[model samples]
Target: MTAISIAPAATRIPSRHRITKVMRLQMVNRLTYLGIPWIITGVALVISIVVAVLISVSVPEPGRQAALEGMAYSWAGLSPFWYLAVVGVQAVSAIFPFALGFSITRREYALGTLVTFVVIAAFNATGWAILTEIERAINAAGLTFHHFTALWFSEVGAGSVWLSLFTLQIVIFAVASAFAAVYARWRAMGMLVLWTAVALVVLGLIAFALLTGSAVPIIDWLMGFTITGFFAALLIPATLAFALGWAALHRAPLRG
Candidate 1:
């Protein structure tokens, strides 16, 4: 019934946790949850930066090459993006679970979700930092940073200039939750189909508009679909739907 991310705290508590214990508990939980994301993010960032620098320094510059010569460098440039995506997916995987945990179990669930989001946040941050560092490194090398401008991309599958392009950690969680809800409610794939349809339509529109002129404004709006915009877009909805689910669950609580 409740989301794991935004459930309210219990009114009743033991005398031991009157104040200090409560504060201690919250802090402890926050730190405990944060550790995983931070560690994972750190590892991924380090590896990505090292790999990118290696590739960039190793690939010898050419006098003149084909149209796609930039593509090779582009590929080398993507290591950071890969690391970020890997970290991002991991981060996103925690979104619903954290929300679900917060909604259902009160403090315990909240704690779990907190830890998970910390991990997720860590990855998101890591992915971003790696890309920023890579760009700076490339700039320092006095080379052109190609295919990376503003905030849009040709495809989610293409280019790594930006980490969120490939994987918007928060959106995945939101979409995943929608899918899970559909699956649980009707054993249907309506959510999946809807998502697919939405993707196709959006992509088509972007392609058409791009052919005619820059669609940076449109793409920027769409970027809100990313985790960076999850709080603004999905969080409110997620919390609201979660509240409705809570009412239903209480009327007929989850079966043991």
Candidate 2:
């Protein structure tokens, strides 16, 4: 008799619950990807300024070679503009992955993120570059990327090479992450071509360094890597992220 009694109640999902969950996830992911790079860029710039000032005051105004030595040890020095390279790339990295869900398919979601990424890259890089220039003027080392590269490739001791390695890793990571992110979003052939050209220029810089036996090689490589590797790398991931997003946005439907 008890077994025949009642029917079960149907479940209803609250819209707020769904909205909150998605919002929370997106926010967390945004912070993880965007926050990390931004902080690094800022802190690096600060350290660079301090080190540059210290070098300027601590070292005696000397000959060209001595100036070179001081430049080598200086922090962010004259490359704060390099942050555009980092944060700009990071913008693409943070949002493209989110495109995988396609849940937020407004035109704004698609284009806005890229725009924002570009803005962040540009703003941060510009600010950093300006600050770096100020530092360089104060210190007056006249160092070049080529100079740094020569030290990196030479048979210098580990201490000499570590800074180069750190720089290379940071640069590569920023560019790679940007490329990967762009790839996840869409196939922007024009942008890819631009990046490819940029990367090639980097290669050219390398060639120039080699010809001159200067530190410029690393800068060349980084330039080449950015335009070429990252320029095009963004395309592939962008496609995947778009495809998945499209699928998710469309509810299950019957095949015609």
Candidate 3:
């Protein structure tokens, strides 16, 4: 009898393990997602404080109080949001190809990327909530500086603040993810077309609102939303963007 040769069956990784691995892979460069954001936040805080102090000093004492009080909103608090968009784009564009080379399936990569977005959004939101409270306390102590405590956040309770921030971050990240996925699938030309389409759509909407004389009504409708309600409404677009990103990545090439 001839000796029989048999090959062992290939071991399959559980979906959960594969997903977790991808998440870990994305986080390997923690500085991009975590450290840099905080650094930017800190820089923004410092700039806000400096500007507040300068304005206070520039004004007469009688007007200084009014000046600071009038600062209902600070753009500095929004700096991190912009950086988070970059993080979202890099999360896919920079990592998708690498992940594929490691034998990660497209499904696994998409799901893992989404999970990472949620985790990062939650983490950043928590930080923002804490900072908002701290800023509130500082302002209450009579400093009158606004960094994390934007006017909208000041109007809401703490829970609402956290929820709104979480929603906003998720929306920003999801939209960026969609853009990055499009880039991955079609390269630079895809991004150009995407942005052109976005610009035209925005212009069309503006033109419609202007010509139809519904701009005020639209503004009023939007302004009527409570802080939480506004962010919650944003969930619609966020969901669509997330879905679009996933679908795009489903067939994205490994080399891109």
Q: What are the per-residue Cα lDDT tens digits for candidate 2 across 108-215?
A: 343444334344444444444344344444434554322222222233333324333333334443444445444444346634864897799889977887888976
Which regions of candidate 2 deviate over 4 angstroms? 1-38, 45-69, 72-94, 97-102, 106-110, 136-256
Residue 234, candidate 3: Cα error in Å is 0.8
Write model 3 residue lDDT over 24-137, tens digit each, in one string.
898898898899989999988888778788987799898888787666655667788898999889988888888888988999998898888888888988998998898899
List clash counts for every candidate, in order.
15, 29, 0
TM-score of each: 0.38, 0.35, 0.90
Which model, 1 or 3, shows the larger lDDT?
Answer: 3
**Arrange candidates by TM-score, highest first: which order?**
3, 1, 2
Best by TM-score: 3
Q: Please report how far candidate 3 places residue 250 from its true position, in Å.
A: 0.9
Model 2 C-alpha lDDT versus the unseen true structure: 0.45
CA-lDDT, candidates in order: 0.43, 0.45, 0.87
